[model samples]
Target: MECLASLRTRVHPVVVSAQIASALYDTGLQMVVKERCSDNSTATEEDRQKAISNFYMTYTMLSSLLPFVPAYFLTRYGDRGFRKVPIGIPLLGYLISRTLLLLVILLELPIEVMFGGAVVYGLCGGYSSYWAGVMALESASSQKERRSLCIMGIELAYGIAGFVGSLSSGHIFQIHAIGNKNGVVLVAFCIFLYFLCIIYTFFILVIPGTSAGNVEHRQEGNVGILWNIVEYPRSCNIVIVLLFISAILYDIAVAGGMEMLMSFIMKEPLNWGADQVGYSNAAGFVIFFTSFFGVWLFSKFVADAAMIMIGMVSFAAGIYFMSFVTATYLFYLARSLTLFALIPMPTIRSLLSKQVQPSSYGKILISLQLSFTLASLIYSPIYTKVYQSTLSWFPGFVFLLSSIITVLAIIPISMVGWRMARQEGYVSIEGD
Candidate 1:
């Protein structure tokens, strides 16, 4: 009875951790930028832009590159017996990183030291393993028919928590009670929250019995992980492959575009303060809720592939609008236009989940994560460099490029839709 109760009460720690981490990382990075660039009265605008760009690039590179191996092992081995290890390890990494940030602030250490923190975090599984664990747990626990809703619910929880945390983070950082040094109070709160997540994940959370054991018998063979990777694509249908590719492209475009947006808002025409940054981030989180609603509403009548196509169109339009953004109101307008933008990735994930066998969830998610990380490896440095080079002439060029990439994402999604229709034996009528 006690075990059943625990299982009933289980909620993924990633929800809270993602929220707190987003708030802390966003505000914390801003503080780092201010200290590195603006704090020196002698620093020129060019100096500040270069400093911020270099710091973010270094952090992105390290964070994305270091996690691949550990994350792969965690996801692969996790299916064997150690389910919680994937979630716990990343949470531990988060704790260490947040602690390091606090110490960096209180001890007046160099902002570059945060690179070490990123390394520690990445080595422990980072976002890839953490999120994959969350998805795997949800996929295992919920009925197949309800899995899509369950995943979307998780995203909604993550988004709402992020919205609340971001809304308050700016105020928390500005609190004068913690001395004149910025982000001390905010970092302290982050540390406390991370600590709570670690405790709850280690002690309280439970995986339900339904998905607890390795139901799919692996007795057929002990093919090594490398062989399994080589076999994965050959095993999957072309539709699944295209779906995976579409998901990867959308993620890369969104990530690269947002990275540029972060740096963009910090500079010239819109020199966003911490409060403005908080509000902007809050607005971004609002998309999660809006997207959830969009998915729920659209799922009633539209095919998943069609829904994804709509989302891609919305995102492309939003990015196009963002390219012309000069005022804060226009920024908000651009965000509003993308309210349905959050739909594609989750929908793509849902489509992919439906295509795979139950036992393959961990492997499939790991593949998706690897693709996302690989895309980051290519896009982050390129986007940062492009942003820096065009800082004086066309800062919005990245957004235009993002819009183009999103439009291109529509191709694979369209193919998936056509495949689905054919599989369903539905004949297309021209101008019907």
Candidate 2:
């Protein structure tokens, strides 16, 4: 009973539930967009592809663009002890947005109405506040030595949930609740799951007080400081700024490639059906597992930055390989090369958490996430446009572009590692 209570209080359940709901919602939206764009009697394949891609880019814009202020404020409050506010409000947004998708399916409304749903989602804080809050909580709960593992474990839970949800998402999209209608049941279940997430987060979830490791660090006044090189009352922390730039660049590479990968696989030689889409999404989730294990095993030998670089190389090689994949098996083969791709971001977040005082870590994380949202706003449309223009000439060009950018993203991390080595009193994270 004590163990059961402890388990219930942990955040893993919330991560699992929310990710499951997200998988269903994403698959539902994609299929709906595909159906609608392809329904026009005179529309060619390229026209359907362009239309679908346009909707996604626009939806991503609205969902990401408006969250900057609201998310900042939400995490600001979260940092000050209104912890649940940041998390609960975004779940509320998710519930509302998901409900809109359901209504679109049930009422046969124009798919463009989802743009409003994205606006509501962004205004309510979107992923920036929610993930920042979650990371802050996780960071506080774990010891410094175990922080990376603890956070990676949360990601593992998220990935497992996504995998299970996506594995069944396609079949669920075809299931009808009352009448024989597509996506009604799937979106309904997504709403139901978010409802559970909200309830669990608010009523049952327990926010842990600071763990001993972070407390000890707080007590170490200026002794183990990583950013001591920066003068006091500084205009900006250069290391943090560099970290943000690195994270955003990596996010651009990942998001741009994956966003277009959806449209790419949906058309032409692959022409993936709903089941294949489910399988492909499930394949993507597999990286979380691999990355967690990579961190666990690699941490014993290599530094955090090295682990991040390893992950980046894995992705760079894989995405570049993706540029040549002409068959479904080849696509999966390319994906297989990215087994460690998810490692870099979480490791980067862990590094960020350690750099700040506990009281101010939430702000830093939210700043990073908001920057990622901003990057998505800029890159989504560009990747879409590039994919459309190259559709006839070479559809996989964007993947190659992402690979090059991923390689570029590595330089900043290498700088950080070199700086750490050059700094006195720093262990440089080469081992242990």
Candidate 3:
């Protein structure tokens, strides 16, 4: 009975709700864009590709710019006892922004109006703040030893929600409402889900009390934490810095590859429709399960840093294979090779959390997310243009580039593993 209560307390209802809403919104918007681009029968396939890609580039760029300051502020506030500040604000943003998409479908608004929606979303701190806040709560609730798995558990909920949502979203999107209005029904459902998420997060959610383990670490005078890593540990700062570098590099590679991939599947031989796109997205979410189990299984034998390398290798190999994929089955086969890919980032966050006091979890995690967003400002547009220019010669060039970059990211984490073993003698915290 006590264990059942504990399990119920750890469950995150809002995370699951928001992710389902997100999956629905993604499919709705993608189909809308496909319709808008195809409205002109005169446009070539490549022309349609460039148009869709351009829309996302501008939308993503807008979304990235306004989040840095707001996310930091929300996270900072959450750290200082306003535990709901980060999550609530972003949920509000999601509600409003998703509403805008609904209006776009129903009222026949220009797609560019989503630029305004993105702005509204960013002002409230976007995904960076929301995810960082959620992780902070998770960190507060668990010991350092099991933090990786605990965090992965939140990701598991998120992925399962995304998978279920994506699997159904395409079918829902085909439902026409109010005089043959396409996606109105789907976008309306998304808004309803977000509304529920906002209410759940702000009203019903209980922020877990800080764990005794986290309190002990904080009392050890590591309050300086990720700001400085620690005082006693030799080369701690170096390890932390390397972790940051590797995380940012890995994120860029993954982000760039995935962004171009949506466009890739929409063109030429693949030319994926709404259902296929949903299935593809569902396939991506399956990795979250495989990766959670991968961590569960692998952590018994290898260190955290080793698990990070294994994930990177998984992704790099999979993405390299993706470079030659020309068929739907081939794409799924490439995706299968990435079974362990989602392990790296959350595991990296778990390691970083171990370095910091609980008070700084939101700050440090938000900072890492913000850093990745900053890097996206540089890479996102470049990925768009590279895909455009290479359309005829090779559309998969970006995937190959991502594979190479993923390999480069492994170097820093490898260095951290060596530094810990040879010098700092940092024991892998597996609880007392």
Candidate 4:
């Protein structure tokens, strides 16, 4: 605690400087409103406040949809093209669509039109990961060193991108506001700007890396949509049971904790605005990027299981501390620490790749996606209920539940290594 306090004393000034600059920009927007509209006697203060609140809610709902649909699309179609169109083109389409939607938020587009575009954006964003995942699986060697490094590099790059993306959002928004663009126009323009990045990614970043391999496409045969869950119970290796359960527990912990943090911890208790969510999220991404680099550096010394255990400990501690935080500094610290929990994800995914036969790689990835989707659906709604009902008491409940679940997961994950060793006859455990 003392060390954390000392770290905060050193770090808080930097965070404060950035946050203050952002707040000043928002303040400037408010000043624009004051200056442009003389007295504006027609619009009551309550009316203006109501519009702002509604816009914020719409944004949140749209953002949530962004990740889910895109992931599903990508999972289903990332490797294959539509009707012989180059797969890259459709992927480009998805990215462009998402860029437009994100731009909507950045440019401050009309809430109504953006609400529609957001749906498409969410779907494309989800799909991007599928392409990346397929590429990783195809390229990585089965050797532990090569696979670990490959997964670590991808995850580190992703975290760095996310961290940078967050910082960029604030600056873009500030620029738009300073130029006197309305919400709708500003957001549309922002989308245009990001779409350029997507185009570059597709043409420049993605093209060279992709190739038509001997990878077999899934049979579009008699496999029913729902039956895929139970029918392919063994689609993954026997160790999948452990991975499934662990993924569920970890995601549950994450979803529940985030609900507590955003809905209650920072906003309701601390009396902060929506923009604070963006800043805090950026800070978390920075920490997550740092932890991912740690995964890269320590890949040789760390077993995937050991890294997961460390992540769980950090997650539990972060959640517990978050539940009790009263100071603003503590909130930032808790969020930063919690991102350490995310560092183990790519490592776990790499382990999953190893457990299955090489022939079953695509199927296993699909199954993993299904498992996580089901877990998220089951967990998020329940967490939402708990949060809404208890209000201030919710964070503690969510954190405690996560801690207990992590404890339960320990034994199962331990058995995973043993199970893998029995199948492969060669133990890939760290220090072996």
Give TM per candidate: 0.91, 0.92, 0.93, 0.66
State each candidate's clash count: 0, 0, 0, 17
lDDT of 4 by residue, 13-55 (tens): 2222223332332322322222232245686543433343334
- On TM-score, the stronger of 2 and 4 is 2
**Pairs in clash, predicted candidate 1:** none
Q: What tens-digit string does per-residue lDDT give for candidate 2 at 1-432?
A: 999879865889989999999998888888888888888989888998899889989988888899999999998877666567788899999999999988888888999999999988899999888899899888867788889889999999999999999999999998888567899989998999999999998887766552422343444455546545445333126667667878899999999999998899889899888888988999999999999999999999987888889999999999999999899999999999999999999999998887777667788899899999888888999999999999998999999999999999999888877665555234445443
Candidate topping lDDT: 3
**Once superposed on the true structure, which residue ranges of model 1 sit more than 4 Å away at CA?**
1-9, 12-14, 177-179, 210-236, 426-432
Residue 424 lDDT in candidate 3: 41
344-384: candidate 1 lDDT, tens digit per residue: 88777777777766566777887898789888889999988
- TM-score, cand. 2 vs. native: 0.92
Model 3 C-alpha lDDT per residue in residues 215-327, reported as the tens digit of each score: 43344355444446445364666778999999999999999999999889888799988899899999999999999999999989988999999999999999999999999
Q: Between prediction 1 and prediction 4, which has the larger TM-score?
A: 1
All candidates' lDDT scores?
0.80, 0.87, 0.88, 0.50
Q: How far off is residue 267 in model 1, in Å?
A: 1.3
- Superposing all C-alpha atoms, what RMSD in Å does each candidate have to the true structure? 4.1, 4.1, 3.7, 10.4
